[model samples]
Target: MADEYRPEFIRRKFTITESLDEVLKQMADRYYQGNVSLCLRASIESYREILEGEGYMATRRIERQLENLVDEQRTLLMEITSVRSGLQESHRESADGQQLTEPSMTNEMVRIIELLKTTGDGLEFGDLVEQLDLGMHKVQPALGRLVDRGVVTRTGEDGERFTLAGFSQHYLRSGP
Candidate 1:
């Protein structure tokens, strides 16, 4: 009868919290007695109770921690997105080589015709890089060429805006 007796009955009646404590006690006893199977069973049942219990504050704490973690993750993602956008804008602006502030009018005129012909809609300096794939450094000199040729005209301060000049037709066919 001693050989047939099992300790499984000890796990059936206790509350989750009480059951977990009992299971730990049983594991300690089993380890001393060399009853590995009994120790393993108690450990498994204790885990089941903890997971199924409605009043488990540990679970709630874990969920709150996860939510806070998600919020931090979202904030980091937004920061990365903003930084990437700034870099892309900077790259687009510099793609055309250089600024056009000192370009000769002749070079400016030729560049203007090319810019309009390529874009159809006029281009800003930034747009020039995006549309023409030229660097900003090359843009000014080319714009000067067009300006001197009388093929392009600037209408605003900083040459923020431009128009195909009196000779749009000539440049349109001849290629700047």
Candidate 2:
């Protein structure tokens, strides 16, 4: 399958100075039976030694520069990983400490928490208001404040439902 497409052969033209043309003509007449392609190939082959020497030196210099750039990229990646590891460690430590330090809950928050604890799954916005016998204006702001404090999280597709922040991770995993 891979061998189906064969590349087209392309011949490149090289312009020679008058002096070089004279030399190529003399060489062709003496040996190559007036074939210009043969004379041109031979003429180009004669310069391989000097041309290859310069190309080799240039390639070596470029290889060294590429090696330096690769080394720099590796070092940068290591530094980024180290910084990320440190940040994760600090976050874990802080999260653990937060459990020990509980913030004071408001009256509405206390009621919401109690209701959330009673329900095994979670509660939607309308359900919360209906159960608590509160207006939408009062319930919305209270829930918003609780969410800001991280006491509760808004879940579900439209984020119309609420649940205890810690407990939500378990029950709300399959939903929003």
Once fitted onto the true fold, the runs of candidate 2 whose alpha carbons sit more than 4 angstroms away are: 1-104, 168-176
Q: Model 1: per-residue lDDT, tens digit, 81-126? A: 9999975664332223223233333443445454575443356767
TM-score, one value per model: 0.31, 0.37
- Give per-residue CA lDDT, model 2, range 1-176, as digits (tens): 56787657469977879998888788898889987678877767666744878657777889999999999999999999999997555434233223212345556666776677666567998899999888888888888888887767877888878877775334333433
TM-score of 2: 0.37
**Candidate 1 residue 139 C-alpha distance from true site, Å:** 21
Q: What C-alpha lDDT values do all the predictions have?
A: 0.60, 0.72
Report the error of model 1 at residue 60, Å: 1.5
Query: Cα RMSD (Å) between model 1 and the true structure?
Result: 15.6
Q: Specify the highest-lDDT model's number.
A: 2
